[model samples]
Target: MTLLTALLNGAVALSTAKIPAKRQSLIILILLIIASANSFLHLWFSEASEHSTNIFVTIIASGIVLSNRAHWTASILFNWVGWITISVWLELALIQHFFFAMAMSTLLSWFAHLARKKLVTKQIELEIERDLAIQHELEAKAATETKSAFLANMSHEIRTPMNGVIGMIELVSQTELNTDQKNYLATAKRSADSLLIIINDILDFSKIEVGELTIEFVEFDLEQFFEELIHDQHFHARKKGLTLALSKGDFHHRHVVGDPYRITQIMNNLLSNAIKFTESGGITVHYDLVTLGDNLQLKVEIKDTGIGVSETALPFLFDSFSQADTSTTRKFGGTGLGLSITKQLCELMNGDISVKSQLNQGSTFSFSVRLKPPRQTHKMASKPPVPVSFEGLQVLLVEDNEINQEVMLAILKGLDVNVFIANDGLEALATLSHSQRLKFDLILMDCQMPNLDGYEATRRIRAGEAGEIFSHIPIAALTANVMDSERVKCIEAGMNEYLTKPVKIEALKSVLVKYHKQAPAQH
Candidate 1:
């Protein structure tokens, strides 16, 4: 009888545990029948031998503990103690003692299965959440990359033409013209300059959005840099018939190590806003330096006696694409990105910016940037190498665009340079490889061109494809791509210098002077 009970309970436990929960009904039913049979046999055996070893109860309990659904049913069947178990009263000869032990076994097994099921469900839910978070992060990253690429492409397309427009106009303006014609040209120039500023602002904003904006730290004369900057903005203030002055605070050091360009940008934004918003009186620029052992903090304040910001608007003044009001934007013609860019630039330099003002009285805009004294006192004590004369200097202007070529040629010619044109990289390579061609003093290579690009041409040049005589020729990238990543690529391609298009005369001249000084003496 004990063996029969063992076999029946064991079969039910094994079958139910192995079968799918949804497909375990047959197995469950068998479990119910086995529980009933076990109950009756346990009672009969208990009566036949009052000194029974309780082996039947032990076998039933083992089966209950070993199987999942079967144990759960058996637990319930034993007065809902397991999933499905028989009532002790259902036994024709119920033995209270034997039934008590069987009941206890199913109850314990049922509780264990219940706790385990809860744990498995919770684990599955956590895994699902983790997967969803990962998917979202990946999607966001892809979206940011796509936006950055789009901005880069658009910047190249737009700047390429802007380079031509501004360059050509400057060339035309240099020629003889009447006062009226000059006035028209001056207005055109101002309009072009404003347009360029807007384009630059948008590009800068895009770079900041993607965390691609890089800050460069180099030794520079801080006082001189700001002095020149204020001098430049003085014209705008003078045009408005307002006063402008700078109080150059006593400095601990004349030269400090920091990102001078970004500092200039921050100052430009604040001072421009102060000038633009002011209607009466004047603006004063104040600066001070604080020494912090290993670092220096340069603080600047721009005070303007102009229209001030409303209390409501002051909070969001530094937020991207925001201004005092929409009407303010309509009156002040700006992308509302300048202040936002300034705020971020300050933070990048481990500094901060703030403004205090009321509606009509005026506002004081203050910002600070951290720097450090040069490790060597005279690291940048000397000014940059002065540009030499452009007379008789030779340059190979490798460009595909005719309009761009015309603009570059006019500028180069104005500088009295001997300019040679190569329509594409392949042509530039062919020109240099020729034994009879003029040994070019410098190669002003354009990056993107048909047939072959400048990068490959430069690599080949460096690899002796253009003969060892010209292989060491100074190559400067003169392209429309303005991203820093693009500059890195140009350097990797063996170019020594990078200058972007709509090339400024001074900038182009600087590059020319650099290579000319180092140019191999003509044969």
Candidate 2:
């Protein structure tokens, strides 16, 4: 009766105990519940033997204690009492029962210790992996920032020399020269322009990598865009003795809303690549429409019969600083960032790019992008006509450089316009102040001059004593600063039009005509 009562009390204690550790807590709880139910049944039934009840309780209690390191000693004491009681009840040998209980406890305790060590080791390994990932991420961010700083510094350094070269070339072209000198100057100018383009590509790639690039969508004529692109690239193709051809697809309309600058950039990169690679065969560009569900996409394809890319080099074509071959770098010089920038710009506009090539035959690059159809609103068939001549017009030319001043004078000589020259902004102000009797029609202000720059000069003229006479004068800003912010600065500085240095004759003529008609009537 005492043995049976002890078994019932042990079963209730085991059932009430809960496993605290999470790894095997649920399994431990389930085993304990099963053992408790078995013990209650054995105690309640009349046919169940006391020896069986004692043996079952001893085995379950031993397992629970052996599975946990904290309970091993207590479990052994409890199991020993149960085992002895059962052995006596069943009339079994005391030595054999004691040996069995000791062996079971030793084996279970060793197994539980081994499992606990392994669990601790796994947790340490996970912590190490997480720390390594964080370290790598930080290193990558530092490298990217370093690269951006290098690119910005390089761009500023390179552009300064390029501006000097192009400016000097413009000044030289205005001088009286033999055919040989003129031809040499033209070649040098072309090389400088190409270098400028490469520099721009590098700057653009840096902007893209740092997430500073953005697209602006504006209404533009698709046909006009194509025409301008062809005009700009045809000279390069001609110089290389390669044929350049364009095949326009049937678009049913001409005007579309898109980012003209980015589209032009992509087209220029593709066209320049094609021209650079091809030596004998021609290059061709074609476009077509793609229909996907309800959306319309445009696909532009540029194909060239050039020394094509190898199988190994094809994969890294769009990677920054990677070129097709080392010899290609020496033979066909580039910064190798054009295609990388082109691909990123396309993706920024929700488009994709692809390329296909053979070893020696040729290569074809393609891109696709969705665009809304042209609006059906009324289209102006004709633009307002510009005046054909700048004859009999009064012009002001302000420049600090003597060579540049002479160059401007020579260009304006045959235009039949009355020209006045000033060495600096202060000189320009004096000239204007003294010449109030003969009202100046147009003021061409140089942006960077001694005593006062173009911005301050324009402001002063607009706010000075000759406010009535010069305030209404159409002042055009001329400078080498071609950045978008520079353009905005010129506009905010009271200038009517902005023209970059090394100005094209046609562009200057157009500006003159634009402001001439818009200028206020004389008092």
Tens-digit lDDT track of model 2 for 390-486 = 6767889987777666666766665566789988888888898888778777888888777988889898898974556787688898775544455
> In model 1, which regions exceed 4 Å deviation?
1-106, 379-381, 384-388, 435-437, 464-472, 521-523
Assess every candidate by TM-score.
Answer: 0.80, 0.61
Kindly give the number of clashing pairs for every candidate.
14, 0
lDDT at 316 for candidate 2?
97
lDDT per residue, candidate 1, 104-147, as tens digits? Answer: 65556566556655654575588789999999989989988888
RMSD values for the candidates in order, in angstroms, are 6.7, 12.0
The 0-to-1 C-alpha lDDT of every candidate, in the order given, reads 0.78, 0.71
Candidate 2 ranges with C-alpha deviation above 4 Å: 1-186, 202-219, 231-243, 259-261, 289-297, 347-350, 369-376, 383-388, 464-466
When summed lDDT is taken over every stretch of 10 residues in candidate 1, the lowest stretch is: 79-88
Best of the candidates, TM-score? 1
Query: Local error of candidate 1 at 492, Å?
Result: 2.9
